[model samples]
Target: MQTKPTKSIYWGVVRLLGNNFLMAATDEGLCYLQFHDANPAAGVDEGAWSELAKWARAQLPEPNWVEDAEKLQPYILQLEEYLKGLRTTFTLPLDLRGTTFQQSVWRVLHEIPHGETFSYSQVAQELDKSSAVRAVGTAIGANPVLIVVPCHRVVGKDGSLTGYRGGLRNKEKLLLLERAGM
Candidate 1:
C-alpha cells in the first residue's frame, strides 16, 4: 500500500489594523494566510481554525497542525509592516500550492507593483493569455496567500473594487494603505 506524505503545518492568530487573521506555515515556508474575522463585534469565529485545517489537508493528505506563534512571528511582523504602509514588497519564502495555470496567474499578480492596480484583463494579458480573463480571475480568487501575493491589487477594468476573500472592506483598506505609502 502507498503511504501519503505527512506534513506538519504551523498556525497562529494575528491581530492587525483591528482585525484578526489566521496564518499558517510549513517547514518549506509560509503557505496560508487569511482573514479570521473582519468584525470584532460579531466575535471571533472558531471555525476559522477548521478552515485552516481543511486547507492544510488539501495541500497534504496527512496534515499535523501545530499552534506556534513564535514560529509564525516573522510572517506576522512582515504583514503588520505591510499593513502599516512601511513595507512594499515581501521577501519571505512562500509555499503556494495550485494548478500550473493558477501558478502562472499568481506569478502575474506578484508582478503588479505595490500601490498599483491591475485589471483582470491586464493580468490575463500579462500571462499572454488575454482570452483567459475569466480563468485568471478564478485563479486569483483561489490565492491562498493574500497580502504577500497581492491579489488585492487586482481591480475591475473600470478601476472599481472587485471580489476579495478578505471582504471588500478589507480589500479597500489594503489598497488605501498601499496608496497612502506612495
Candidate 2:
C-alpha cells in the first residue's frame, strides 16, 4: 500500500488588537488560526507553542510543525488590515479541513458579506438543510481559521450574541468593527 506523505504545517505567533494569535499554514494554504490565552497585563505567553503542538497531534498524523513567521506573513498582514477595518474581504488561500457538512456550512459563512450578520438557522437554510441549525452551530464552532473564516458574523436568531471560540468579547469587537465600516 502506498502511504500518503505527511504535510508540513508551519505556524507562528502574532499579537494584534491587544490579543495574541496562533496561526499555522501549510504549503497548500493556511490551516489554523486561534486566539492564544494571554493576560492583558502580562502580555504574550510562552505556552502557545505547546498548545499548537497539542492541536497538531490531535488534528494530523505525526504532524511536522515548523515555526516560521515569514511563511505566515501574508496571512498576518491581511488579518492586521482586517482588524484595522481597512479590508472587507480575504484573498488568502485556505486549507480548510472538515467534513462535507462542515465545509458546506463554512462556504455559506464565506458568502456572508463583511459587516453583515447571519443566524445559525439562516446558515442551515443556505445549505438547504434548514433543520440542521444545531449542526450548523457545531460546524461554525469547529472553524479553525478565525477572522479569516468570519464565523463571528453568526449571531442568534433574535440578533443576540452567541458563543464564539475566540470568546464573546472578541466576537463583539469583530461585529462592532464590521458595523463601524472600513
Q: Per-residue lDDT for 28-111 in model 2, tens only?
A: 888899898775345336676666666667678787768788999999999999988899999999998888898999999999
Candidate 2 is scored at a TM of 0.90
**For residues 1-182, what per-residue lDDT tens digits would candidate 1 score against the true structure?**
99777788888777887878888899888999898874543544768767776777777778877878899988988998887778999999889999999999989989999989999999999988899999999999989999999999999999999999999998999999899899
RMSD of each: 2.3, 2.7
TM-score: model 1 vs. ground truth: 0.92
Candidate 1: global Cα-lDDT?
0.88
Reference-based lDDT, each prediction = 0.88, 0.88
- Candidate 1: stretches off by over 4 Å: 1-5, 38-46
The RMSD (Cα, Å) of candidate 2 is 2.7
